[model samples]
Target: MKAVSLVPSLTEAVAVTLPGVLAGATDWCTHPADLDVTRIGGTKNPKLDRILALAPDLVIANEEENRAADLDALRAAGCEVLVTEVRSVPQAFAELARVLAACGAPGRPRWLAQAEAAWAALPEPPARRTAVVPVWRRPWMVLGRDTFAGDVLARLGIDHVHAGHLERYPRVPLDELRAAAPDLVVLPDEPYRFTAEDGPEAFPALPCALVSGRHLTWYGPSLAEAPRVLGEALRAARR
Candidate 1:
């Protein structure tokens, strides 16, 4: 079964689990480091021509990372596109299972089981702490309610100060975010590339955690290690 995966995490999931099934993937699908598939394009603006040229039997995409018009175009062109909606851990697992099964993956993949176990092993967080997590700068957008990353942080005992906002990814003024009096600032290294010197200075009064964006934001094979990896980073920077 030939497949074209637009989401990086799902690309890895399909490539690593099914092997030889992916005929094309987005440029951002960097996992399986040695992956040698046709480069279709980016997640938001995929090269529809190239994807169609690949003649993929299935195309995997995400509701959040991809554009609706593009998926509509693919469907209009008579291509079967699998659109995944992953907003939480359990939902991610279910979506993965559904996609894999739909694509004829041989039984349950080992990584899927490992990922489930990784999160299940974590004991309930003792006491939750309020945090401001900025995903981008220049305009300053944050993770709000119903985000997968927010739930991951919640599992690690960190609550979002912007969870009540109207937008899932809201752009708040920097001053207003600081005024919220968050206990810490959790910075991920992607979607904005926040580093120690650059991000920590914004909140001199609060402890800052520099986390891996893949572990904190992505939903796939990384789930197997995200819990331990993100938890350690949060704990190390706890004030």
Candidate 2:
């Protein structure tokens, strides 16, 4: 079954689970490092013409990562689109299974089962800490209510300061974020490429945990090691 994945996590999942099924993918689908598919474009702005030319039997996407108009256009052109919504860890697992099944996998991939076992094996965190997670800077947008990242953090015993915010990703002023006085500031290295030299400076008073965006945000094979990888980064920042 030929498939085109617009989401990076989905692309990796498909590539790893059912090799050579991907006919096209967005430029940002960088996992597997050796993926050789038609580079459609970015997740937000995929090249519809290029994707259409591939004539994939299935196109994988996410409700949050993909634009509605683009999905609509693909459907208008008779392409079957499998859009997934993963707001929590449980939802991510379920969606991954569904997407793989739709791609004609005989059964759940070993990686998916391993990822589930990894999360299930994690012990409850001893204590909870309040944190502010920034996905982007410049305008300073943060993870707010009902985000997959927020859910992931919660499982790691980190409570988002903006969990009660009305918007999912609110653009709060830097001053306001500082004023919130969170116990820690978590920065992932994507969507904005936050680094030790870059993001930590903004939260000089608070410990900033610079983390891998793939482990912190992406919901595929990375989920298997996210608990361990993110826990180490958070612990290091506290120390």
Worst 10 residues of 1 by lDDT: 99-108
Query: Whole-model Cα lDDT per candidate?
Result: 0.92, 0.93
Q: Report residue 66 deviation for candidate 1 (angstroms).
A: 0.4
TM-score of 1: 0.98
Which pairs clash in the backbone of model 1? none
| lDDT (tens digit, per residue) of candidate 1 on 1-239 | 99999999998888888889999999988898999999988999899999999998999999999999999999999899999999989999999998898778867799999999988889988788999999999999899989999999998999999988889999999899899989889999988999987788888888999999999988889999999999899988877
lDDT of 2 at 229: 97
Predicted structure 2, TM vs. truth: 0.98
Cα-based RMSD of the predictions, in order? 0.9, 0.8
